[model samples]
Target: MKQFTSIAALTGLISLANAHGFVTSPTARMPGDAMASACGQQVEVNQQSDNYGNIQGELQVASGQSDYSASECDIWLCKGYKFADNKDNVYSYTAGQTVDFTVDIRAPHTGVANVSVVETSSNSVIGSPLISWSVYASTATGVTANETDFSVTMPDDLGSKCSTAGDCVLQWYWYAESIDQTYESCVDFTLGGSGSSSGSGSGSSSSSSSSSSSSTAKAETTPAAVETTSAAVETTAAAAETTTAAPVETTPAAPVQYATTTFATQARQSAEPSVEVQTASAVETTGSSVVSTKPIPTDGTAQEKLNFVESILKYLAN
Candidate 1:
């Protein structure tokens, strides 16, 4: 356990060094996080914070940022995540009020940023984030930081829950587009008034900060052979059934067509030869299994015969 604790401490320090910047203004003040909190120290000008150090950016909720847990996150990079912390420790503000979260831009890497709200009640992402585009850096204002701002609105949907929990968490995530990295920071605060009629009418808004995360969330694949072939068999069978019966005597007969299946294709189909399907037993055993389908003939007795074959195939498929 001692070994694990040391390793975890080392890892947190490493992440802080790499991620590169944090909430400079409206300084993120977490009780367990900052040592100054022990002495009840309010922030003073010219005094540097004891929060995070430079670290990498480009974190996706699915990957980089720490998950919203029922447990408190005492570790450094967990976005000041805490649960059931003392209410006296939190800062207060109005719910549904738009607030600008200032970020200290340390690195020159071009990136996009977002500020969001996570409702403590559900531990879910509540609404639209205040996002900015290819936000570049600027000159420092007081020997403090090269400042850029992310305007965040405490969602009105939070309602009286602000007073209920007496605290809500604000998350700031910056994804470095060029660099495949992410940086995040969080703040805890309370609302002044009820959030009942404040946010956009929509219940919940999705996080659109990282397109990479969006693409990862949506994944599609080619359908399995069984799914494709089974549906095909049913469709071919149905199409065949609609054919009008044609007399063999008047039919211009054509040899039946067959497609040679490779070992892989055969393995995928896992079906028997067409001859097996001729029997009623085989038809009953396989529900509309595909045996090669013939091309639909354009005209004449051949067309009628083609239709007749279709009907037979459809019956076997069923």
Candidate 2:
């Protein structure tokens, strides 16, 4: 009877292992890249394995420039397990399994910057899960900041694993800071099922490896039309001055001279040129300057008058 009980116990253990299948593996190691703009950068989770399969996740970034003297970063894992929760201190999964993931990082300043991720799965209390990473600077700015998001698939063979589902956990570490600053901010991920699991071993699994982002904020400055109007007015005034007409000068003609003669004789000899020439001396000299003045049109406002004057001057100058 005792031998029969032992066989039954062994059978139960084997059945439980088969029901749990294999724990999903965490993503692979990703190198850090630089952020060169105030807008920040995005880093993708790139670990995967065929044995455990792929998982989706998302990342969110916010600036504390006004609240914090230095920049700080926080990463939230909406799904999966964390390294700290696992006994091995590193993500654990069945051998030969693969998991796919992605992350995004943003920069707060212009020029090149570096970012990195670390993985740890051993000696739970002594070391962090980070093993390898990539680093480089971003090359853009403002809305164009050197931010980018990428993804990769990695094999779960990077670390060891446990025998049951509750024994393992997955964790992530992320950082984004200026190369010039000594302080760097980091974020981690924790793992848990998306509330669909029942203890019976028969349940549904959802993807927790994708990310979604909200729209950017609108600009706060005024429109361009106001500036354009001011520029146009100034240009018109300048053109008017350049096109104004120059003043004209006039000279009075010299008085005419005539031979000495009487008015009565001149009248009687109007038909005779010689007599008319002699009679001209009797006429008195009259001086006059022909100063002609035309009324300036005043029907329009000052601006209209200015515009009109400007047009006339421009025509004359041309």
Predicted structure with the largest TM-score when compared to the true one: 1
Quantify how close model 2 is to the true structure by its C-alpha RMSD in Å.
33.5
Residues 189-236, model 1: lDDT tens digits: 554453433332111111211222222212211112123244332324
Give me the displacement of residue 115 in model 2, in angstroms.
Answer: 11
Q: What count of clashes does model 2 give?
A: 70
Candidate 2 error regions (>4 Å): 1-94, 106-133, 136-170, 177-318
Best candidate, lDDT: 1
Task: In model 1, state the lDDT of residue 163.
Answer: 44
Q: What tens-digit string does per-residue lDDT give for candidate 2 at 50-78?
A: 11111211111123122211122122221
TM-score computed on alpha carbons, candidate 1? 0.39
C-alpha displacement of 177 in model 1, angstroms?
A: 3.5
Q: Each model's TM-score, in the order given? A: 0.39, 0.21
